[model samples]
Target: MARMPSFLKPPKKIAKRQLELRAQLWPDLNEGDLWSRHTHDGFSTIPSTMALIMSIMDDLSKNKPVSSTYLELWNRSFDEGFATLAKAREIAFHSGFSSERAERTWKDRLKILHNLEFINLQSGASGPASYALILNPYKVIQKHHERKTRGMREDKYNALVARAIELGDISLRPADPSPPPTPMAPPAAPFTFPLPAGSAVPPSPAAVPSAPVPPTGVPTSESSKV
Candidate 1:
């Protein structure tokens, strides 16, 4: 078997640094759970953060990094594929972000590619060089096509909309006075003594009245006289 590189070897210091960086990155990550999973019983002071970093690193090293959003969209059979930067720019413009901010957000993701050593630093093109997720080579090609398909074609989209209306593909717009949903019928009036079919809600029995007992011991005055 070939020997592994020393730099790539897991070092105690690097492991600590990895944990520190991750803590800074995501403070909410459960440190105890992560440490227990990676290290046995937190006995080792070395940062368990490296364990998490290496998990992602191992995936990349194995050439099994997950798919990029752009690539995933290309694989879908939707008539409209993924968006290009140009289309994204239009969306950002409509969404009220400055062009520069939108572009910067995109370019920043390219730093991950540089970190992974996938692209040369000198490449004049500035976009995401690599994606966090692994994608098949065929899918990468498909993504390129998808981006092209999503190019800015306002005229074409408008024409398609008109055609759809003519073909009765679109529904008529409701009147402005359309009533609300009737408040969901007030939750079916709750279960007011509602019993299932054939199961009569047994009527509450009436209170029994005390019977009047005649005075048995004492005879009437007339009877006594007789």
Candidate 2:
């Protein structure tokens, strides 16, 4: 077995030292109205690969930069794996689409995001893009790379892949294919009434009783009458 190289190891000690130096240099940095996830009531986890993801989105969208719009959506998301995009005008306004066509512009960017597979849209009472399921950007980019999608910059994709590798991010890998469904057992035969224990065949029907004949004396009317 070979030992790992020191250069390839993480710089934990250096990072600690840097943090100490930063604290010394700016004592007030952690004080007074600062928002920290530890003390904050509302916060959402954002991916560190967001910059690269945005670059890829811009490339795919051809000059129309949708990164800001994406950020708005991410900001509104509460880490619930999905977001309600019912407030389209508000989101668009925050994303710098405050013109008369603000919502329209926002919707166009959303469509681009959907086409790139960064998010899955579902229509609801709100509108066409009433809800959005945020996808793992790493996986989406990996798929695009595999497909050699048009407008994708190779260098950016390469960097994303390298970053994912460094971070030990397995999200870029394809999901396991689901197993095939188990075949159902054949249906049981139709039910039938069972015969008696000893009898091989079903019992025969009883004979019908015939009408009784008239008495001999009572038949005199037919013999002497008329």
Q: Global lDDT of each model?
A: 0.41, 0.83
TM values, all candidates: 0.17, 0.68
Model 2 misplaced regions, further than 4 Å = 1-18, 27-30, 174-226
Model 1 lDDT-worst window of ten: 41-50
Top-lDDT candidate index? 2
In model 1, pairs of residues that clash are: 65-133, 65-134, 66-133, 66-134, 67-133, 67-134
| Candidate 1 per-residue C-alpha lDDT over 1-226 given as tens digits, one digit per residue, 9 for 90 to 100 | 6565576467989789998998899989875655342344323222223232223332343343322322322322133322233344443344334656764443443343334433223322324332133223222222323354333244433443454456454322223886767654545656676678899677899999997665988877668898
lDDT tens string, model 2, 91-145? 8999889889999999999998898898899999998899988888878787888
Clashes in candidate 1: how many? 6
Q: Which one is best on TM-score?
A: 2
Candidate 1 lDDT at 97 equals 42
